[model samples]
Target: MPQTSQGSQAGEGADPAPAGRPPEHPPRWSWWLVGIVIPLVGIAVTVLTVPSQSPNRPPAPPASSSPATTRPPASPPPLPVGLFRLTNADSLMCLSPPPGNSTPAAGLVQGDCDARPEQFWRLRREETGTGVVYSVRNQHTGLCLSVDAAHKENDVTVTQYLCGDENGLFPDQFWSFRYDTLRHAWRLVSRNSGKCVALPAGSGDGEQALQEDCDGGTWTLWRT
Candidate 1:
């Protein structure tokens, strides 16, 4: 009714602010959550994602090696030492190298068991790579028993000569002993001839020792 003011009518449309209050903005607790709590949560996540540190350890040892192998040495033959007599099983005579003939190429013989030094032979065992063999040396004549060179037949002559050495090892000079356990005797076999030293049937004393076939019974067997 009276003169109404336009400015007062415009202010009347809006609500009035409360008296004695500060201007509205974000909450203090929200600023604390953004600056401190949220940053601490991010740091915990980063620490969980990162790989962990490991302690120092020693390296493993190398694999073990195998032990070395050792081979056994060759053994010696079972023959006697010193001088001995070879008594023929068939004739009961002693083998000798031509009594009083100490020279080479003297034929061997069998005679009465007079217990003479010439009848006694010394067996010298040689340890060769092939096998064990013996060189029959006369105690009196100092000669070694042998067979005629390269003769492989029966009744081949067995002789005595100078003992061969490593320089000239005559194969005939080497002899091998074959033992017959049942008869308790031995057979003297020649290396070159491969025959046994045998006595002929019904032969008497002073008969020549001959190389013969390894058969026809006990004529080849000898006893020491």
Candidate 2:
């Protein structure tokens, strides 16, 4: 017997089936193709469109007029760089270490801070009266701290030397001030380990006072 053609077959006149066989349906590829393509497109779009959230950090604060809680201030200045009048126990001049590089050391002592060029002072930094500094200049020598080497604890000395070499400046010559006399007086201070700072002598500069009970005398009466 002749077979009948099915409408959904490949060819217009394609045969659907033989007498006892079921009609062949075209493989259902449209649904499968759509399912694969839709998921693939969706994944591609997600990859291209999403963004990251990772770049914004925080800030810092202004500086304070103080040392850290556990530590002390750094060091003394080169020498008295500002307007100062020396009072070496009624002696009118600011004292300096006696002559050295000669014989047995005279150790660090006070000489008259007079019109001698070696006694005149200028600041280490040009910024006037800044930090813990007061540049000591020699009036007669027209020179500043000329330490041949860096100064150390206790053995520090001031000299009437030229201020050219980097190591010429000693740390002991410069005076540091902490507010005193109800903030009306200024006292010279020193640091032991570059941390804690305190006055070295009593009001008379005898190396006894701890900046707390300085003698109310002219020797320690330093003005800005």
Candidate 3:
């Protein structure tokens, strides 16, 4: 219900602190050299290492857009829903919503393989107990992904919105990266319909699409 992001207040320009009158000089001592040199060294290191959080700098990488692909397909097919744990492992592959575009989500890429927040997901079974589902979350907005009822192929744009309605439910509303779990890698499956939803903007059409009994393409595979 809140905005995806908020602007921050930048530090305003300010005059440097004044150098007050010099106090009586201390008797020259060896320890004085150590104190002065050590402090100077420390200042230099801090200047060289500590980064300033001033807003004047370029934004810090839009807070890592997405997370890494998890799980391995090695023994995928027969595996139970929750056993497919996400990790820094690459035995996994993410499916782009079908049609054309390319480029993995930032968190699931080679660099971000851990349980980085953006890439975190949970596997779930439909409340009706008909099928399983996976969800990819971006904590920043507290939203998952929504579909443009018209998107039936690849290369479509994915927009951010609240995680609700059919978009937040299963069949077309899931992450399909693990093998044997039913949905394609990072694939979307519509919940109520038991239909495999395609993101024409993210990945491709699966080999086994069935006809839809509902308004949208019923190409869902889990139909009994």
Candidate 4:
């Protein structure tokens, strides 16, 4: 009978264990407090650690002031001054007035290549366009090649006249050059009459220069 009572006592202890599993106490207040306080502390820390802008700070410099901004260098001017000889392509002669004749009416003539001061011409740029106008000045007499009375007539003669003469400025003094690709030569065209400098038919030494319509003929071809 005592063994049966001890077995009943053990069964009763086992039943209390199942009742104990329901809950020993309600949820801890410390855990609830920790959950609420931890989030509040995190929000407070985030607010305190964030950076703020100051209204008194100066503005940054412009992008153009940066090292990447640079300007290109300027280009050089073209040189149009030089010494040359105006040679007739057909006659194979140089244009030179008689060295002693420095008068306004002294006509220019085709002469043998002597490389004299009378044949040495200084070309100076007068204007720029599709073609550039140059004043052909003689190194010997300091005269300029000009048309007779600035005439626009065909077969007119070319002469060496005083540069900037009191007779007044004339376009006849300005000569332009056109390149002849076919002949590989240049045509000396007068600015006033628009005529090409030419050697007369059967030209010889001391023959005067003539103005004719440009036809790319060997007589109209000139070289510097």
Evaluated with TM-score, which candidate comes out highest? 1
Residue-wise lDDT of candidate 1 within 1-224, one digit each (tens)? 89779988889868898898999899888988789888899999999999997987888898779777886543434677887899998888889976787878888888899867888889888776778888888999988888766478887888888788767557788889988766778899887777899988768888998899887478898888
Best-first order by TM-score: 1, 4, 2, 3
lDDT string, candidate 3, 114-205, tens digits? 34343333344434354445454444334444334424454233333344565445233453432324343222444533334322222232
Among these predictions, the greatest lDDT belongs to 1
lDDT for each residue of candidate 4 in 10-121, tens digit (9 for 90 to 100): 7774545554456567578978999999999999999899987667967887678547756664433332367778888898899988766777769899889885878888
TM-score of each: 0.62, 0.33, 0.29, 0.60
Better of 1 and 2 by lDDT: 1
Model 2 Cα lDDT, one tens digit per residue, 1-224: 97666744556766556688767786799879988999999999998898866677656577787976875544434334464443333333344334332222222234535454333344444222446454445443445533224344332432344444476444534444554444344454432112111223432222221122344544444433
Candidate number with the higher lDDT (1 or 4): 1
Return the lDDT, model 4, position 168.
46
Off by over 4 Å in 3: 1-111, 128-130, 146-150, 158-160, 165-171, 174-224
Off by over 4 Å in 4: 1-80, 128-131, 165-168
Q: Lowest summed lDDT over 10 consecutive residues: which window, candidate 2?
A: 190-199
